[model samples]
Target: MDRLERVLKGKLEDSPGASCYWWMGNWRGRGDLADLVLKSRRVLEESGFREGMRLGILMPNCPMVLALSIACWSLGGAVAPMNARSGAEALLRTISILDLHGVAYVEDRPEIGEALSRAGMPSAPCGLEGPLRPFTGRGASELDDPDTAVVFSTSGTTGLPKAVPISHGNILNNVTSSIEHVEFLRPGEVMLNALPNFHTLGYSVSGILPLVGDIAQAILPSFVPADSALSAINAAKVTGIVAVPTMLSMLMGAVLRGGERPEGVSFIISGGDKLNVDMDRRCQELLGAPILEGYGLTECSPVVSINPSYDSRRLGTVGTMIRGYEHQIRDLEGNLLDDASEGVLWLKGPSITRGYFRDPVNTAARFKDGWFDTGDVVRIQDGYITVLDRATDIIIVGGFNVYPQEVEMALMEHPAVSQAVAVGESNSMTGQVVKAFVVLKEGQEASPRPDNRLRQGEAGAFQGAPKGGHPKGAAPVQHRQGEPQSA
Candidate 1:
């Protein structure tokens, strides 16, 4: 395997003039990035992170994390990026899953470094160590076959999370695929790095990929205050960035709260959550950028479908299939569904992982049928697919299929509702009843209205009220001979 060193060399030799990399606070140039990566690489190479060694990476979202990632990859070590806030249980679990040889953490933060040092003091584990210095040391050995660049625990959101084993090939392919799909990543466009680095989206879009691909990345410590992201764009004169729907919502709120948005931004790429059309429109009003949502998961090396940067976007849909991926929807019986019909969405592509890390059972089960089961119910209409619900969260309500997302989306439309999650309740009469938990908008009451009292499974469902209750004669839905009534 040629590995990341070859790729980095290719970028430096190939795109030397690409000044758009990491914009850390006041630093907004490529020379700094190249120097930083080189230094970090030396430290890593000296630390014995040779080929096939697994190294755990724990750090917050910053330029240092990006440099360290590139450094580890350069040394042919498997880089596992873990969340800094992760508890001891999650950390130990991650280490075990990756079969991590040892861990390397940033000593830049005093508090965190102290905690991690204390955490590691109890045991005298035999693992590599390096002194804290501005990246400098010997490079990797002269001759050795390259290995996988990084590994990360699977999102497990769909099931028991497995540690995902991604090769340098996987990362390169994903980055290439995204660059192909995005189209207008200009030579000098500034990007806001907001998503967590531990996630596939974070490390891909903001960390290593953009630098290698020659895009300017402005780092925000995190995306908590959309103001920080927006302010960076305004001050840095940034163009666009990739972010989640929640950040967009918060940005829109910030704009509504009497703050002007960064004027130069054309648009942003949204992922990792559902895109709200209402919020997107709000963004179009505030930021002047159409919020384009892409569908993806950790298994696909993350990206699957994305709305083209310049195309007219569809509401309630996460755009067209990404390049080099065959995406389809299929029913439970493993039969493929036609357009406009709903089914489990499945994908097969070059970006798809070879398998889970060290778990052949999951690999076989998830990859056996020639497609990865997304476990998401969706409908493809006119080349646009709308995600209906997660298969695990679908509710069977009174013998009728009631998708919780449908209810939640409907309820979200109400002016008083801020957020809603619908779950199933086991019932004596009905198999399950849809019960919604809502966080109302400020100043709104959860009090039920008179119209809300109308009974379900009765005449009030569609036609009219019962005969005696109506001012005039009305037809109640009548049950014919031996027919079962809903109520």
Candidate 2:
């Protein structure tokens, strides 16, 4: 048996009656989970699932995701999880790229059914409570690597989605290293798995970590409706939360609107994007838990570094690298830099993937000499990593590099501003100038003219500020929930 199967079986044997997963106000025991995995495996086999094939799963975060993944792995197949919220066109593109043997989707989404039917791909309607119904498609074929456990779809540097196959060994290494590095993942603690399963961070950290680490978890289909999430957290007595910064923001907003804070939360693990300082401070003040921000990329089994604990964490850095990773800092021209310098990050380790599934061009471009180039520019000071910005997101203002996160942080210093995103606008003189889109706090009005206080604050906070004045463009816009406003 693979390590995942061995550990899961051991967990079940050790605690058959212990609650393993909590969903929709009900808890399922470890034995119950084991039975579901067995039933799912039988159903899949009866439906023509075979060893060495890839099965596509289109669903939110739920018990079925874990059940089906375990079942596939046991049968020597892999599971490829696609974003259910991604519309039919995007879903169709993913299906074509992965060339899956079969797919299982939630009962809803008739459009997806239609697309699958048009494409002649075998599919089934799946849910938390029913026997899976089979559909017809091509026969299973042997995979290049039968040890592949999960295949995730991620957009490459060209802005097109590609398939990344993560083996069982990769996941086991990450989970083991993370548990050893972070101290809070104890058996009795309940982790809130609110992030979507389609995201790598969600799958690896929130979804799989708790299971293999023998910790009980509360699973939410989605993180929206913060009031509902809060209820689940309280009901499960959750101790840890792994989510993106935006989810924390929404939960905080709900609290500000008179919702009760979740009880017993020890720490909030924030990743998927840069966690703003204001949001971190607000979490501490309102939720009574410290936000331990982390940094990762989809290609690196999703987690590279994280703030290990509340007592040992530095506010601005993502803490030290996890165990077993060898890293180097490289200049833009590919020359290696000193340990304390700032530049693009390159990583090599057991958890790092070999390459993309079949795109040799992209694989060749990114993976070189056993090191994967993570396109994020970061500064490492005494082992703590401070992610500066994405190399592609940097703007050049008359030969000076301007990091957008710095500008956004400066803009957010104003009390009236609730959120900010900075981008580059074309300018004849500087080649590119900073442009900012600001969202004001509720009941706050934008000033007709630029505020001197804000200007002075920016002058001090932003060292890379373009000469002469504030960012060339500042526009107030309405805040759209869950929609990223980036260039």
Candidate 3:
């Protein structure tokens, strides 16, 4: 049997009385959770959920979400986690794409029911109150298969969501390796998991890691209402928080407005995107814990590397690769580059998924000789990875390359700007140039010439402007004036 199946079954058999989850003001033991999972598995099997079939989970971050997913897998079927925020069209497309047999949801929304009916998909209620069943034998056959454990939905730059199938081996490798490498939390500590369970970050870190490691998980339905998250942290005595940059910023805002800081927080892990330096520093100060930023993608099952909790961590770089993973930098010509040279990042490891669910052409283009092209430009020095920007987002101006992230970071340094996006525009002389659109903070007024309003050193790549108060070979467009900013 695969490690995932063995670990889960062992947990139920050995330590069934241990508290495994804290949700809705109650704690549930491993035995209860295991029973719930088995019952759900029975329900699916009785409803004709056979091996190789896929079940869609339309729930958010709750214990049932994890239960349903594991149950589906235990029954020799895969689970497809559908985004709660997906529209009807997107939902229909995903349902059709995966050929989902049934979808489990908390609430019976008429629209979702109608969409499923139109697509001929069945729906199941998200409930754990069911009759207990005799424990079945280990699902060795399904667990041994190293493909299609979970069909994860990834919203690419431009398209409907792409379904990425992560195998049992892939997630098991990532979760177990990350816990051993990062050492973020101990078994008894509570983990506040407010990130949505549909995303890989949420599923692997917040859902599966806590379960397999025997840590207590306090799950929230959503990340909004920072006060609720803070309360859960305080009430549960949470020791670890897994969140994105925006969630950290919002929590910091709540603390600034008189919300109490969570005591005994061992560490806060930031992922899904790069953590802003300003937000990182402020959140560390506010939460009284170091914010360790990691890097990953949906295709990576989805943690590639994370800062070690017990060692010295680099402030700006995603720490060394996890156990059993390898990385290399490749140039535009597909030639490998030495450490410290910027190029497209390619990763090879057991945790990496084989390919996109049903897109053979894109899959062939992404993978070359078993190495998956990450599409992000990065540099590796001294075993640390510093992500620069996407390969497609690089701007070449006058033969000099510029990454939009650099320009965006520079723009954000200005006190008046709250958010910024830098894009590359065609230029006859320079090949391409950087065009930035920025949003002003509340009550912050911009001068007629934005170039003049920028602080010294704030225009990193655009400092060499020739005329028109803009970068040479570039055109600047003002998208918005002073706008209301959300906390």
Candidate 4:
């Protein structure tokens, strides 16, 4: 058996009756999960699946998603989890690029079926409950790397989604190092897995880490309808939560509106985006847990570093890099910089993938001699990493670097602002200028002098700009109170 299969099989034998996961309002035992894996494997085999094939999955977080992943590994195949909410054209493009042998998607979505048909791909309908149907596509195996366990989809710099194939060893190293670094993820404690499984952070940290670490997981289809997420937390008596900043903000909003704070939550792990300072403070006060913000990317099997504990954590920094990884700082011209200097991050380690799946051109552009360019500009001091902004997201105003996160942080200090996203807008004088989109908290109104309010926020945060005036050649900050921000 492969390494992943061996570990899971051992867990199944060691804890037959222990609660493995809570889904659909019930806690299922390890033995029950094992049975599902076996059944799933049988179904795959019947559909002509074999070693060295790739299986595509388009579904939310559920038992079948986990079961199919394990089943694929047991048969020496890699599983590709795609976003279920993607548009039909995007899904079709991804399917064509992946060259999947077969696909399993939610039964209710007809658009997915149409995409599969257009791609001439084999597919089957899947659900949270019920036996999986055999795939109808003619499965011709192509993948030959037995070490590959999962092929995660990430949006490339060119705007199309690229496939990242993560090896079993890559994931195992990440999980082991993460468990050792965190120190507080004790076995038997329940973790809430509400992030979509299609996301690399959701797949590795929230979905698979709990299983390998002997920690029970509470699964939700998605972190929507905050009531459902809160119910899962209380029902499972969850002790840990892995979420992005948006999810944390939503949960905090729910709690403020008379929802009970989840009991026994030890700590919240925030990744995938910068955790807002105001939201972090509100979470501690209302939800009664410290938010341990971390840094990661999909190419590195999802996790690179995280704040180890509440007491040892530095509020604005992503804690020390985990074991088995080496990092370097490089300037815009690709010259190596001193540790204390700020630049883009380059990573090399056992946990990092070799390259993007079957895309040598893009992979060559990003990876150099085994070192992957993370494209995130960061500063390292005393072994702690403080992410400033994406190298691409930085705006240049009068030859001054304007980091969007700093602007967003300043905007969030306003009482009425709930969330904010800052982007670079084109300017003729300066290369680019800052344009912010603000989301107001419920029942909160924007200030009448919005331009003055933005000027105050920017003036306090950025010293390069004059006190009472806007940044040089910069346009007035734009505000949209109730509009949704695109992901």
Give the deviation of candidate 3 from the true structure as CA RMSD: 11.8
> What is the C-alpha lDDT profile of model 1 across 14-67, one tens digit per residue?
655556444445744554555666876775666555766666666557666665
Q: Estimate each model's TM-score.
A: 0.72, 0.80, 0.77, 0.81
- In angstroms, the error of model 2 at 228 is 0.7
Flag the better candidate by lDDT, 2 or 4. 4
Better of 2 and 3 by lDDT: 2
Sorted on lDDT, highest at the top, how do the candidates line up?
A: 4, 2, 3, 1
Ranking according to TM-score, highest score first: 4, 2, 3, 1
In model 1, the Cα lDDT at residue 358 comes to 67
Against the unseen true structure, what C-alpha lDDT does each candidate score? 0.61, 0.77, 0.71, 0.79
TM-score of 4: 0.81
What residue pairs clash in candidate 3, if any at all?
none
Query: How many residue pairs in model 1 have overlapping backbones?
Result: 2
Per-candidate RMSD, Å: 13.8, 11.3, 11.8, 11.1
In angstroms, how far off is 366's CA in candidate 2? 0.5
lDDT per residue for candidate 4 within 186-238, as digits (tens), equals: 79689999888887888889989999999999999987878778877998899
By TM-score, the better pick of 1 and 4 is 4
Model 1 residue 183 lDDT?
Answer: 68
- As for candidate 2, its clashing pairs are none
Candidate 3 Cα outliers beyond 4 Å, as residue runs: 1-3, 128-147, 155-160, 392-487
